[model samples]
Target: MTTAMGAALRRIQLGNALSAFGNGFTIPYLFVYVSQVRNLGASTAGVVLATLAVAALLVLPLTGRVIDRRGPLPVAIAGTVSAAVGSLGLGFADSKVLVVAAAAALGAGFAVIQPALATMIVWCSTPTTRSRAFAMQFFLNNLGLGIGGLLGGQLVDPSNASSFVRLFAIESAMFLVLGVAVATVRLPKAPRLGDVVPAGEGAKGGWRSLLGDRAMVQLCVLGFVMFFACYGQFESGLAAFAVEVTRISPATLGIALAANTAAIVLTQFAVLRLVDGRRRSRVVALVGLIWTVAWIAAGVSGLVPGAHGVATALLISTYALFGIGESMLAPTVAPLVADLAPARLVGQYNSAFALVKQLAMAVGPAVGGLMAGGGMYGAYIVLLIVCALGITALALRLGRRLTPEQDNPRLLARRSEPVAGSAAAPAPVACSASH
Candidate 1:
């Protein structure tokens, strides 16, 4: 990468970390802020949360087309400004209607930001560096959120509504900072919609071309299951099981969550090295195996409920195990999406994948909540375990559809290596996806 590109990526990552820090302040407190602090009932709080999802769904499809047409910079800046307005509105909005509306704006802003930032990273880094770039992004995001949550927790008092307002105001300020930082970034000239698609066809042709890539479609399917099985269960199925079945306290659950983040923050670089030069598909398969054990550990925790100490330890380990799997995925999944995408269509692919994730986040919670709420805890554990194993199956299947260079990018670097005792470069390796 050139110096300019590196500088742009650094600025983007810094801004991303700061924005995530602000988002963290609200994440842990949003439910409480809406349901109790704002004096809105639990039902209203539910609506606010649902509204966020609805807003994302409404925005993501169009977001991709706009990014592809106008470039990620403007899209990213627009998103941050919208998010700032939403965050600031939430700070002072006490009524349920106002809260829900604010959430809609925030959600839409977030939906746009994710794909926009991802495309920017894709543009800034070459394929060889892309995996590490995304890994670093994931690591920073988690670290920022972790610190912000810790400090925000220290400052918040449920009895004082003004404290919550102050938290939201700080969040708004960070978003504006993100917008300013992004505006300073100078991206390489990007392909416009017309450059990628024929004049008359427009966005539909782009979508059709995207859907035609068998590997991408399979990855999207795999993405849904992956998110549904693990991330979907984090605060819903798994937390409920820990509380109701294992009979662990909410405070303990918080500790387990911290363990998850700590595991990611501490081990990310180590895991990055470990997975480097390896096949991304097999790496993802390995993550499935890890999560399989995580789900089983969670199940065992519930079964040994009589021994509270044992149960709590098992549950905490379960979360830590999930964290380890997450570390593995950080370098694999997103890079694969970029590799599959045509260079001109990177934004579209990123947004489509983000849409899939949001769908899983929406559906996973609803299904898990039903199972946990209905006291079908045993079934829930079994279902998630099956989904985990399915991830492995799906990955290996997708591997067959990937070019060697796409599946294992290190081979590209190896192919480009200087031949021993030779002045001239080695012959280019002929690789096939199907082979």
Candidate 2:
């Protein structure tokens, strides 16, 4: 990568870390703050939580169009500002309507930030550097979240409602800071479909164009199941299962989460190396297998009629294994999304995938929670195990659809070397962000 690209990437990563850090303060504590501190009751708090998801669903399609038309930087700035306002508002909202409205703003901002940031990464990095860039993004995200959560825990006081307000104010400040930081970054010009095709030939059909790609469609499906079976369960369904079935203590649950985060921070680079140059689909399939084993371990933790120590060990091991799978996916899935896009449609594709993820996360907890809570623990584990197997099957099929260059990018880099009569590839250029 050129020095300019390097500088741009650093700015982007810094922005990512700041946004994630701010988010950590609210994500882990929102339900508690709303339900207990505000005395809105659990049902109201649940509605507030659901409002975030509903708002994302409402706005994401439009956000994708805006990103595709306007470029990512402006969209990112807008998202951050919206999030800052919503976060600050949330601190003061007492009425149910006000709380939900603030949550809607926060959710819309959060939803847009993802694709905007992802598109910026694509514009900033060459294909050779892209995987590592995304891996670093994942690493910093986890690190920021871990540190933020740790600090947030120290700042929050269950007995004092005002303490929760202080936490929200800090989170809002971080969002504003991130917005200012990223606003200064200069990114490469985004290529549009019009740039690559005849005028009016390809600019008309937006998401319809994206949905036409069979591989992308299948990949979106895979992503949905992947998130549903894993991320969706992390805090809600999985935690409830541990509590009700395995009798896991709160202290042990914290340890398990720490193990997951630690494992990702430590293993992300190493796992990236293992996945680099390999077929991405195969690597994804391997993650599925790893997670299947994780679910089995989770099942064993609950079913084993033995010492408490053994069950705790198994539960922690399950989280660690999930972390390992996450580490592998960090490099594999996101870069593939960028590679699959038609140059100008990167934002649209990214937003579509993000929407799928949100949907999965929204549904996964509810389904997993119901199953685990309704004395259907065995069925819950079995369903996720099947989902894991489905990931493996679908990935192999998707691999068949990808060209050699799409599946193995290292080979693409090697093969792209200048030939005797060929012109050299253009140098990376830095473009100013749109106002």
Candidate 3:
């Protein structure tokens, strides 16, 4: 990379960390701030949460087209400004209507940020460095969230509405800072909508070309299941099971969560090295295996519920194992998304995948909540174990559809194959969707 590109990469990563930190402050506290601190009812708070999802869904399709047309930096700056405004509004809004409206703006902004930054990363890094670039992004993001949450927790007092307001203000400030940070980044010129063969074709063909690709669709399916089985369950299903079945205290749950974050923060680099030269599909498959063990450990924790010490240890182990799977995925799935897209269409592809994730997250909680059912009959454990195993099966299936270049990028690096310019870009894999 050139010196300019290196500086740009650093700025992007720093901006990402700051933005994540800002979100961490507000995201965890939203329900409490809305339902109790703001004196709105639980139903209203739930509406606010749902509004975020709705706004993302409404805006993401449009966002993809705009990114492909206008490039990611402008869109990202716009999103940052929107989020800052929404954060300030949410901080002070007393009425449920205002709260929901603020959430809508925040959600739309959040939706755009993913694809915009992803595209920026693509522009700044060559394929050889892309996986590691994304891994570093993931690591910094988690670190920022953990620290932000810790600080927010320290400053917040449920009894004091002003404390919550102060937290939101701080989050708003972070967003504004991130906006300034992103504005300073200089990206390399790449294909935009205007550069495509036909002026209007890029816009119309963006989603069509993406959806027409069998492998991309399959990967999206696999991604959806991956998120639904794990991330979806983290706070609602798994936490509920720990509390109701394992009979663990809330403090223990906190410890388990801390263990999860700690495991990722500590081990991400090591895991990145391990994944560096391997097939991305195989790394993902390994994540499935790791998470399989995690689910079994989760089951073990609840099996002998009366043994509190044993259950607590096993539960913490479960979270650590999930953390390991997360670490592996950080370098695998995201880079694969970049590799699959036509250079001009990276933003659309990222947006589509992010859409899949949001959908799974939205649905996962409901399914997990139902499955938790106070941990009756071990249903939740059995279901998640199957999901983990399913992840492995799906990964291997997706592997068959991937080009070797897509599956293992390091081979290109090792052979000194050029990873830039139109000639250097690998051809899309030719494979049927039939499974």
Candidate 4:
């Protein structure tokens, strides 16, 4: 049984890694492809990327509903196929309309895929093992991202537009193959609809039930802020900063990204093993602090005029530290989301979490760019302040909600024990309506 469990985990991890690789392949070069190759300005490219985030936010609720009804495997297959089609179309698109359409399609597909993937991970593990399972997924995802970034840097030659287009074609093929892979795998049946009994009563009351829970609400808020700050630094600002502030060649930038990815991949399991169910909010808070410091370091490094090599090294180290914090925080957040969610609305709960993140990713860049106009240091300072505030908020909220007794594993184990004469509760019904 243990061996079988391990094998199942291995399969899921491999699938996640492959899926993430396919998903990440285009991101490293997307802005460059849009701006330099397509002749769109940086602001325009940012808007295009933001459009993807908007699509994701708009699509996720509907996708979550579909996953609740049809199960994750079918949704995963559809999402992967859609992503492939979109990416392939992107290769052929010359006009802004076509590009935005393709980007929207890609974003929609990814949005559909995320909730299903997360649901599958949850389904495959016991609560005790969920954090580690997610950690493994995160590790492989980051590793694949690093590898994809490195490969993209090599593949995307500005002098040869054909080469860049070919890379997109290859990315399209990978997505298609991954879709098939997901389709081939057998997944567990989804929980029955309407199975969850809400703490309150009324139609559409499930949402109110979820919102009424202070802990869950706070978790969602923390998630929003964390992603808002992190994405602003890593996704929007990091590459541009590397190009402008550091004199490192594009190849070296890729290496530095690879190093950041390596830190996430290698350290995730170790961090997961060390942290487990204990001090989850504290761990998240610490991650925020680490990220803030990393941003500060990166900003400070930029102030070292003309020492581009040293500055670049410091910047990479800063990103590496951010990666480490992310490695710790990412896996922890999912399980907490699951735990805090009412049993009946897990899909909705997960979708809400994704929504917060998508919203953050969508809006963070424009704000970051505005602050960063002064310089990289200005951007870094803004990020640092955001992280610090986010951490403080999370700590205070979590501290008030979680008691020392609840934090004690032995106490939790005892609390979880069913009363001697209690009837076995029926499982919550899964709602199937499209969002």
Candidate 5:
């Protein structure tokens, strides 16, 4: 990477870390603030929570097109602005309409930022460095959230409404900081929609063009199951399961969540080393195997029969195992998305994948909650186990469809290097992210 690009990436990472720190202060408390503090009731809190996903679904279709046309920097800035206003608004909102509206803005902003920031990272890094770039982003995100959650927990007071407002204020400020940090970045020259193809190409058939890529479509399917089987359950389904069937305490559940973040923070770099240069599909498949084990452990936690200590251990391990799998995916799935995208449509592909993630997140919780809530604990665990296995199968299938370079950029990079005693090595495969 050039010094300029390196510097730019650092700025983005720092801003992201700080922004995540701010988010940590509020994420765990939003439902409580709405339902209890504002006296909006549980149903209203549910609406507020659902509004985030609903708003993301409503706005994401247009996000990619905006990023493709206006560029990621401006789009990223806009996202931060929207999120900032929403965050600040949440601090002061007392009524249901005000709270839900603020949540919609916050959700829409966050959704826009996903693809916008991803496209920025793509523009800043080469194919070889892309994995590490994404890995670092995931690392910082988890790390920031972990640290923020820790501090926020210390400050939270169920009896004190002002404390919740303070948390939201900090989150809002961090979004503004992210905006400033991104606005100053000087990226390497990259092709926009016009430069990569004709001026109207993006508009003419952007979504159609993306859907036309067979590999990308298959990958989206894989992406949905991947998120559904794991992240989708973190707060809702998994938390409920831990507390109910597993009979774990709320405090223990918090510990389990901490363990998950701890696993990711400690293992992200190590997992990156193991996955680097390997086929991304294989790495993702490995994550599926790891999570399959996690879900089975989750199932066992409930069945362990009066061994409270044993059941708690199993539940925590279940979360930790999922964290390990997440660390692996950090370097695998996202860079592959970038590699699969056409240069001009990187934003489109990123947004589409983000949309898939949102859909899975929305559905996964509903299903998990219903099954778990309806005395279907056995079925809930079984369903997740099946989804985990599906990840492995879908990934291997997608592997067959990727180009050599797209599947394993490191191997291609090695091939392009001249041998020690030879004039040159074989030319690198043509497939590469056009950053």
Candidate 6:
């Protein structure tokens, strides 16, 4: 790569890392604050978080349109500013109603950030290099999450609201800083809608066109299920399970999450290089199997002698497997989405992708919380089935839709070749919020 290209890539990576840090810095604490400090039940917290997701879901598609019409940098600037304001509001909230409102604003800001960042990433690289770009983004994202968890753990004082508020204030400041950084970066102009030739032109289409594509739809469905299984374990159940079944302290749980983050950061590139696009289906299937086994082992670890340590190990292993799976899934999925989408409707395609995932994010916690409340075992059982089903569905769908040619590494390398008469060359679009 040229020095200029390398510099640009580094800048993109830096932007992504900062964005990830801003996101993670406040979120772990937000959940803990809502549940523990505010004295709300797990299910109630889930509902509140889910409501924020719903707000994101409502706005996410519109953000895609905005990115298509305007440029990515402007949207990113708006999003970061909004997120900062929302985080500050969340810090000041004194009532449930106010908290939920602030959370919704935060979610909306995130929704705006998602597509703009994604489009920028997509625009940055050739298809072959896009996977590595995404892997870097994913790695930084997890690393940031780890750092945030450690920071939150150190900062949180159950008896002290002042400390909690102060941490949130820091997070708010970080968001504003990130927004400014986004504004400083140079990005290519977005393509005009009329410039690109629409794919699947004969089909009656709007969102329906994007949704009706068999492979794209199946991928989205699988994404929903996969994320539902993985995120559910952490968001709704882990802390309670640690306390009740493993007899571990909140601090230990925080440490374990930090460990998970470290594992993600250290191993993501190695895992990404290993999985590569040609083997994505197999990799995904293997990841599902690993996750299922991890969950089962986690459940049974509770029955082991020295249950706390065993359960912690099992859970950490589960997260490690998730990180590996995510490494593979994140890179491959975007290229696949781009492949399936009408070239002219990149915004719609990106939006639909974000929309489905956000919808799942909205629903998964509430459902998982309900099952977990029944029993930790019940929650694991539900997650196991979901993961297994998602794997099966992804394998079958991709097997049918993706030909040997599509899966061929040589063909993938040729992805940067422009479709004849297409409006413009395809760009590397990374959907950052997909994390």
Q: Name the candidate that leads on lDDT.
A: 1
Q: After superposition, how far is residue 218 of candidate 2 from its true place, in Å?
A: 0.7
Residues 248-344, candidate 2, lDDT per residue (tens digit)? 8888999999999999999999998888899999999998899989989888999875677888899999999999999999888999999999887
Tens digits of per-residue lDDT for model 6, 72-102: 7788788878777878887787677777887
Off by over 4 Å in 4: 1-8, 36-47, 190-203, 238-255, 306-310, 374-376, 379-383, 402-435
In model 3, the number of clashes is: 0
What Cα-based lDDT does every candidate model obtain? 0.89, 0.87, 0.85, 0.70, 0.89, 0.67
Candidate 5 C-alpha lDDT tens digits along 1-435: 666677778888899999999999999888889999889999999999999999999888888888877788899999999999999999899999999999999999988988999998898887898899999999999999989988999998989888888899999999999999888876544563354755566544889988899999999999999888888898878899899889999999999999999999999999889888798888888888999999999999999868989999999999999999999998888999999998878888899999999999999888888887798888888889999999999999999999989999988677777768977544321212223
Q: Over the stretch 88-168, how does candidate 1's per-residue lDDT look in tens digits?
A: 888899898799889998999988999999998888887788889999999999998999999899989999999998899
By summed lDDT, the worst window of 10 consecutive residues in model 2 runs over: 195-204
Candidate 1: lDDT of 117? 94
Best by TM-score: 2
For candidate 3, report its TM-score: 0.93
Residue 316, model 4, lDDT? 84
| Residue pairs with backbone atoms closer than 3 Å in model 5 (clashes) | none
What lDDT score goes with residue 21 in model 3? 89
Between candidates 2 and 6, the lDDT winner: 2
- For every candidate, C-alpha RMSD to the true structure in Å: 5.0, 2.1, 5.7, 5.0, 3.5, 5.2
Worst 10 residues of 4 by lDDT: 426-435
Instruction: Quote the RMSD, in angstroms, for model 5.
Output: 3.5
In candidate 6 the C-alpha lDDT for residue 32 amounts to 69
Worst 10 residues of 1 by lDDT: 426-435
Cα distance off (Å), candidate 2, residue 214: 0.6
Off by over 4 Å in 3: 192-197, 374-377, 417-435
Q: Can you write out model 4's per-residue Cα lDDT over 21-107, one digit (the tens) per residue? A: 755667777888888887866776776787788889888866655565567778888888888878887888777888888888888
- Tell me the lDDT of candidate 1: 0.89
Which of 4 and 5 is the better model by TM-score?
A: 5
